[model samples]
Target: MGVALRDIIADCKETLDLDALKGVAAIDAHNALYQFLSIIRQPDGTPLMNAEGQVTSHLTGILFRTANFVEKGIKPVYIFDGTPPTFKQETLDQRREVRTRAGNAWKEALAVGDIAEAYKQASASARVDAYVIETAQELLGLLGIPWVQAPSEGEAQAAHMAGKGSVQFAVSQDYDSLLFGSPVLVRNLTVSGRRRVRGRTITVSPERIVLANLLDYLGVSREELIEIALLTGTDYHPGVRGVGAKTALKLVRNGEFESTVAEKLPDFDPASIREFFLAPPVTDDYNLSWSAPDTDGVVAMLSGRFDFSPERVEGALEKLSVKAKQQTLDQWF
Candidate 1:
């Protein structure tokens, strides 16, 4: 449940390209992998698998997409989530239930030969298993792409990096990063293509949201923004029974948030959740560096273990190498 600020926020612009990023990006790794698993499925709703029957969509997504980023002079630092806050357990359990239902729905739709419905449900049912995560880590390591394991949510860590000026932007499809104080957030970095709406599919571009611009335009402080999010709902808590984005904003603006929350969520502690968003767990025990791809390591996993074409693996790595060299040369100058 990302912050539902889309209805109220107007500082977003969808005119960004890879070349515009020309700086470091802190990516929400788990989010990106989940997107890959959801979108890279075949027409019949089956994921691409290796000879041993393991999913390879995540690997393929990371390889080609990250290479494109690198080739365009954008340095990406993938951030993986660690432990989750106890408050988010409910949200995770609900997601599991949705996935289970989606899985059944996907099978039923497929059985009935409803191809479109099957594809939609299959996308909803996609899960990033341990194998996918581990293989992705191995591949990122082999490609010499720097990654950080967050103490909690990857979005928090990515936001921290951006806020601290360690990266150019905090990259994710969620608007929650704004609550985490990321100076800038980029959405659709991975899925920058056509998106389906109610009935028609429309081509979409990458968009950027600036924290300062949003706050200034909304006439609310960052702290107040958190209050609005708490009132509307978040992954950690199920906001007030009847509150919504518009009403939440009104309450925040009128300084009635505390009174409203007290009446609606008498037994719940909204302050703590707000504080958690204001400052989530993050770490600084990682370095941001782009080195030559570990050719042997990449070969071992993609070719030896996963049976990916050796030529394809080498070709992708070669692109990374060329960009790494170009980055180094630019730095020297």
Candidate 2:
């Protein structure tokens, strides 16, 4: 559907005319690192390092985005993925394989002095260190946002908070929140004012979608819908060969999967799947509460350690201060 979480934010910004965000809590997908920093070893044994002798994008994005959202006045709650579902491992392995092939292609392009292709391929080759979920947690502490390391996806943590009436909505660019059965998943929670991407000025108008309503229109149970999604594909499984939303639903509705396929379900592995739905359980890991924005924490993490500009960090603080004042004024009115 190309229906990204960021798309939701863009649409919300366009349609709802949302004010500087006042109440809703925002959640980050991972550590918000910008680039890959680990190591890439070749077949014979060679290492890849930038001119600076290290990787930084993945770490940098964490600092940048935390400041980014705080400035926009959204209270961010950073969540990191912990132990994952067993089925997810196959997806991760495939991603590395693709990156390896792409990296080789890029390396070949670079060797030939093809500047564009070199830059592209150089980008393709470094695939080792993108996993920076830990940095996200650390940065969250620094930015003063409460963070939860969930046993699984960050969206699941965000969804649980919203479902239990703790915060307002789960915010991210991923559509999987709906699959996780979030009460509300606010998409595009990160778009800022539009700017030129290439020669053209790209306008970004972020928006939110009521997943409950979307589910209603789609006309399948949420469990089956997500399962169908899994069968079709996800960020976790891009283009899973045998399935898609419609087909998955058809299979779920049919209720005749072989025992081998049925064995993969999380619910099925549990002694009883009904217990999961019956209680609407909230995982115990997440915590959501605060005195105000953790301004000092934000500054310390970004400006102090990662070299984020002070002005950028302060800009976020200013927005949170404004939101706090607005609430105070509204109380009088």
Candidate 3:
């Protein structure tokens, strides 16, 4: 999970039409793949799988969603996460426990004919395994979409690309990108459409968060913001008990951050966490390049290998080709 700063940062977000977004974006590949595996499932909680029982939901998502991005004039560069920091082991372990519980719950729900609960728990149990990553990378390569392997967290690398002006923004569903120093962060890019929540259907649109505007609005420095997250919670550390986003914000603004941390979290020091977010490991060795998709290769992999419908594969390729032609014509003028 990301840092729990949404409550304090809600006012900083702005909704935008898909047409308004254009330029290169650094996408968190793991985050997006998880979304795909979670949301692109059948009503019975089963993922889209091939004859050999291989999941294809992620492949379908990357192919169609990347085409949709190209249609909207957005060039995406996916960033895959590397080895996580040692401090995050606790969080990873907790996630594993949660997934195990959810998986058992999903099976129980299905056995009891509770489709809704099964679907919900299956969504929570979604995991991005090595097979998913390898297949996703292969599909991206066939589609001619560039990907970067980060030295640490994918969000940090995406933030670095955005901060360095290599990309217009970072795309993730987590607020941690802001903590990672991404100048601009776009959320809901992968799942931006009609979605069912609770018992109602609602429209989900892409939203943008600008770091400078957020800092100016909050009247706090970026370091202070990280302090707020530390008091609340983050992937690296469990925050102070009973501290929330608003409470943490108040503590930081009142200049009582140190006093509160010392009183509540006597055994924990936040300095290392602060330094990690501020100066996280990142690499500049990646090349961002977009090229025409390998049409025969894409068809062969998706249709022949994975058993996707040839017609749908061609339809997605057609969208990519049309967008490419439009861009070419616009440039020639």
Each prediction's TM-score against the native?
0.94, 0.68, 0.97
Which candidate has the top score in TM-score?
3
Each candidate's lDDT (Cα)?
A: 0.85, 0.53, 0.91
| Alpha-carbon deviation at 173 in model 3, angstroms | 0.6
Q: Which regions of candidate 3 deviate over 4 angstroms?
A: 190-192, 329-333
lDDT of 2 by residue, 1-333 (tens): 221323222332324433545455646454233132222223222333234434445545455555555555566666666665554577677767877886787667757766555554554444434334555556556455677666665666667767767667776656666666667766545454454443256765545666666656556666655555555555544433545455555666686333424654434332222223223334775556433557787677656666667797677666655555565544311
Candidate 3: lDDT of 293?
84
- Backbone clashes, each candidate: 0, 31, 0
Tens-place lDDT digits, model 3, residues 27-82: 99999999999988998689999899999999999999999998788998999999
- Model 1 CA lDDT for position 162: 90
Q: Which should have the higher lDDT, number 1 or number 2?
A: 1
The clash tally of candidate 2 reads 31
User: Candidate 2's error at 23, in angstroms?
Assistant: 2.8
Q: Candidate 1 lDDT, tens digit per residue, 1-333?
A: 576777777544556765677788999888899989998888768888988798999999999888888887778889988999999999999999999999999999999998888888998998877887888998998888888999999999998999888899988888888899999999887435677664488887788888998888888999999999999888999898778877899999999998987888888877678889998989978888778788888889888988889999888888888877766554512
Candidate 2 residue 53 C-alpha distance from true site, Å:
4.2
- Per-residue lDDT for 154 in model 2? 61
